[model samples]
Target: MGEAIGILGGGQLGLMLAESLDRLGRDTVIVEPDPDAPCSTRRGNVLAARFDDANALQIFFSRVEVATFDSENLPSMPLAPFAGRLVPSLEVLRVSQDRALEKTFLAKHGFRPVKHAVVPRGADVRAAALAFGLPAIAKSTLGGYDGKGQHRLTTPADVAAMPADAPGGWVLEEVLSLETELSCVVARDGANAFTFPVFENLHQHHILDLTVLPARVDPALQQEARAVALGVARALDVKGLLTVEFFVGTGRDGVRALYVNELAPRVHNSGHVTRQACTVSQFDALARILSGVPLNEPRLHTGGWCMGQLLGDVWLAQGRDGGPLDLSAWRDFPDVVDVYVYGKRHARPNRKMGHFVVRADDATTAAERARAFRARLMGR
Candidate 1:
C-alpha cells in the first residue's frame, strides 16, 4: 500500500491536490468541517471535523505519513504537535498568518514591500494614517482574503471610519500606482527549488479574475520576478510550494520597480493555469514534494494560455432558479481546454466556484478568448 497523506483543508485547492496525489499512486485523507466540501466528494478518507478539533487531528495524523494545509489562516500553535510531519514548518504559518509579521519578515530579509505601519487594536488610527499618508489601505493583520477586512483611506473621514474593535489590528500601506500585477509560484524541498513562469494577473474587486501565462512583460523583468520568487523560497527554507505576488509600479521616487505584495505558502489561485500550460502543474509539484519525490522545474508547454476564475456570481446569475449550469455554449469555443467546477453546494456572490482555461497562439488571443468564454458562461 502507498503512503497516506493528510490535508488540512478540503476546499478546491485540497481537491486538486488530492487528484495529483491519486495520479501519483498515493492515498489521501482530507480534514474539513464541511461534509460536502469538494474534497469530501472526491476522496474516500475524510475526517469531517473542524480544523481545531484536537481529537480529530490526532486521528488524522495517525492515519497519514505527512500533512500540509491548504490555507494560511489556520492557527500554527494548534499544529505544533505535528510539526515533524509538516513540510513548510509552523514558523512559515506563524509569519504568514499575520500581515504585520509577514511584511516585517520581508523587510527584515531585505525584500522590498510597500511602505506600511502596523496599527494595533485600539491604537490611534489617525496617527498611523498620517504616517503612512492619505489614500493608504488598511488591512487586517490576520484573516483577510479576497478583499475582505480591508478599507481604503483616501481622506480624513476615511481614516476616522477605521474600526477600533478589530481584534487582529491592521496594517496601513501607502497605495501604489501599479503598472501591473505579477505572480510566480516556486516549489522547493530544502535541497533544491524550482520556479514557474511569471503570470500576469487581472483583479476584480481585489479578487483574481484572470491570469495570463508567460506574463506580458519584458523577458528581463520576467526573469527578475522568477528570481525574486526563488529567493523567497530559499529565505523561508520552504518545502512544498510558495507563491509570491508582486506589484509592478512606480515607487515614491517615481522609479518603476517590483514590490513584494504578499506571499501564499501553498498552491495559489493564480497558478491554476499551470494545469494546462506547464509540464508539471503546481498541485503536482507540491504533491510530489510532500510525497518525498524530488522537485523538477516546471516548463511551459503552450505558447499562450489564460485562466479565468468562475465565481459564485456566475452560478447565481445562471442557475439561481435551480438546475445545473447550462454549459452548451462551451462547444462554440474550441480553444477552451478545460472547465473545473468545485462542486460547491451553495453559490454566493464572489465565492470561487470553478475556473476555466483557454489556449491559443499568443497571450493576447488566449486572454480574449478566455474573457469571451467567461462572459458566455455568466450569460453576459
Candidate 2:
C-alpha cells in the first residue's frame, strides 16, 4: 500500500520505468490502449485503455500519488483534469509535442534552433517549400518519431508529391550539413537538476543506430551541450527528465555551431547506455523524482561504452522459420555487458525491440565491439 505511480503510454520506456519503481519499493499502474504493449505484459497493475479515455483516467488517477507519461504525443487537453499530479506539467508536453511550437519556444527563450517555417493545416505546401528552398525537410508538426511523418524535399517533383491529408501543421526546415548529432539528458525536481554526460549519437535511415558515451567532441562543446540541457530543464520547471538533442555543424557564417534539434520530455533512447555506464540510470533517476526522492547527479562508471539498438530487422532476419536468436556468441565477447529484450511478440522493420551495451577502455573499441556483436546477432 505504498505510493503507487501511474504511467501514461505503456511502451518499453514505461516498462523500464516500472522496473525502477519496483526496485525502489513503489507500486506502478500502467495505462495503455494496446493490451500487448511491453509494459502491459510485464507489469501487474495495468489499465488497458486509451490515454484520452475519460473513464480510464478517472479510475487511474484515483490509484496513484503521481502520474507521468512515457511519450509526449498524448493529447494534453484530455489530461487537463489531472494537471495537479502530472509531472513535468502539461505545458511542457504541449510544447514538446508540436514541432512548430517546440521551435518557437526555443527561439523565444534565446536558444538557437534550425531555421524553419510553419505551414498551417490547409496551407500550400508548394509555397512553403519554395520559401524554404530545395533540400529542406518537411515534417508534420505532431505525432511523428523515428523519421515517420517526415519527407525530404530535394526537387519540385518531391514537393508536388506532398500528401494531401497532412494530419497537422508542418514545419519546413533548411537542411544543414552536420558534423554530428548529440544528446544530453537532464533529470530535475522543482529546485535542483542533474545532467548526464553528452552523448554522440549515430543514426541510420533516421533511426538511432549507436550512442557513444563521453562524446568524442571537443571538451568545450560537451560542456556547452550539458549546460544547454540544464538550462532547458530549468526553463521548463520540469520535475522529471528532459533530453535535448543537438545538431553540431557549420552555420551559414561558416563557424561551428550547435542547434537544438528537438526535445524529448521523458527518458530518451539515447540515454539507454546510462543504465550500464552511469551510477544512476535515467529510468531510476526519474522514478526517484516521482517518488519524492531528491535528485542525485549521475556519474559515469565506465571508461567508455556503446549502446546498440536491436530493431525489428534483427527479428526479420530470422526468416520466419528460424528459432530464437543464438545468443551463445555473447560468451566470446566479455565486453558485452548487458542484453535487454522487451518481450514484444512480433517485430517490423525499424521497430525497437531490444538493446545491448558494450564496455571497453575507449569509445572506438566499444563501438566496434557493439557493432560486431549486433552483426553476429543478425547473422550478417
Candidate 3:
C-alpha cells in the first residue's frame, strides 16, 4: 500500500479528491463532522470527527504521511505539529482565512483590487462605506463562501445597518462595474508552482453558474491575471491547489484590466471544469505535493473545455414543497453532460447540489450546450 493521505473536509471537493487519489493508486482517509457526508459515501475510510476536535484530529493526523484541506475552514494551529507534512502551510491558510488580510496582501503587492475597508462592530460603518463608495459590497471577512455572509450596500443607510452577526468583522469593497469575472486555478509544491489557463466565470446571485476556459478577454489582461494569481501563490508560499478570482473591468476608454477579488487556499469551484478539460487536474497536483512528488505545469488541452453547474433550485421549489426531487432525466444528456451529484440529503435554495462539465468542439459550442443543459433541468 502507498502512503495514506488525509483530507480536512468532507464536501464534494473531498469526494472528487478521493476519487483522484484512487486513480493515482494512492490511499486516503477523510475526517469530517458529518458521519453520513457525501464524501464518506465515495471514500470508505472516512472518520466522522469534527476538524476542530484537536485530540481526535491529532490522532487522525498521526496515521497519514501528509494532509491537505478541501475548504479554508481548517486553521494551522491544530495542524502545525505536522508542519512539513501539511501540503499548504499555516501561513497560506492564515492569510486566506480572512478576506481583509487577503485584500491587504494583494494591495501591498501592487495588485489592483477593489477599494476596501474593514467594518467591525462599534465602528463607523457609514464612514467605511464612504471610502469604498456607494453600491459597495459588505462581506464577512471570515467563514463566508458561495454568497453567504455577503450583502450589497446600495446606500449609506445600508452601511449603517450592517449585520452585527458578521464573522471576523466585515469588509466593504467598491463594486466594480466589471465586464466579466475570471479565475485562475494553480498548484504549487514547496519549490515549484504551475498555473492553468484562466477560466471566465458567470455568477448568478454570487454563486458560480458557468465557467469557460480560456476566458474571452484581452490576451494582455489574461496574462496579467495569470501573473497576479501566480504572484499571490509565491507570496503566500502556498503548496497544493490555489485559486484566485479576479474582476475584468472595462474602462471608459474601452481598455481592460484585471482586479483581484478573492482567493481560495484549496481547490476551487471554478476549477471543477479542469477535471475533464485540462492536461492535469488540480487534484493530481495536490496528490503529487502531499506524496512528496515534484509538481508539473498543467497545460490547456486543446483550448480547454467549459463546465457549468446545475444548481438545486432548478429541480425543487422553496418553503414547504422543497426536498430531494428526482433527476432521472439528467442522465439523458450523456453526450454533453458529465453530471456530478453531491448526494446531499436536503436541497436548499441556491445550494450547489452538483455540477456538469460539457466539452464542446469549441468555446461557443461548449457554452451553448451548458446553457441547454441548465434549461433542460429547469424544464424550459
List the candidate 1 regions with Cα displacement exceeding 4 Å.
321-323
lDDT of 1 by residue, 33-113 (tens): 986578778655888988888898888888898998898988777688998888777888778788999999899998888
Q: lDDT of each prediction vs. the true structure? A: 0.87, 0.88, 0.78
Clash count, one per candidate: 0, 0, 0
Ranking the candidates on TM-score from highest down gives 2, 1, 3
- Best model number under lDDT: 2
lDDT of 3 by residue, 1-380 (tens): 12689888888888888888887777888888885467867556788887777887777777787888888867657777676776677777877888888888988988876767877756666676777678888888888988898889897778778675576778987767788999998688768778888999998888999999778778888888888888988888787878999988754345556778888888888888888788788877777777777777888777436788866676563222233545555676664647777877666678677788887677767887788877776767
C-alpha RMSD (angstroms) for model 2: 1.6
Residue range 1-380, candidate 2, lDDT tens digits: 12589999888898998999999999899898986578867545999998889998988999989999999989888899989889888899999999989999899888989988989999888887987788889999999899999999999899989784465778998887899999999999877789998999999999999999879899999999999988988877777999999999875557678899999999999999999999999999999999988777899986889999988888787653222556877988899999988877777788888889999999999999999999987787
TM-score, each model? 0.96, 0.97, 0.90
Residue 77, candidate 2: Cα error in Å is: 1.3
Pick the winner on lDDT between candidates 2 and 3. 2
Question: Looking at candidate 2, what is the lDDT of residue 78?
Answer: 81
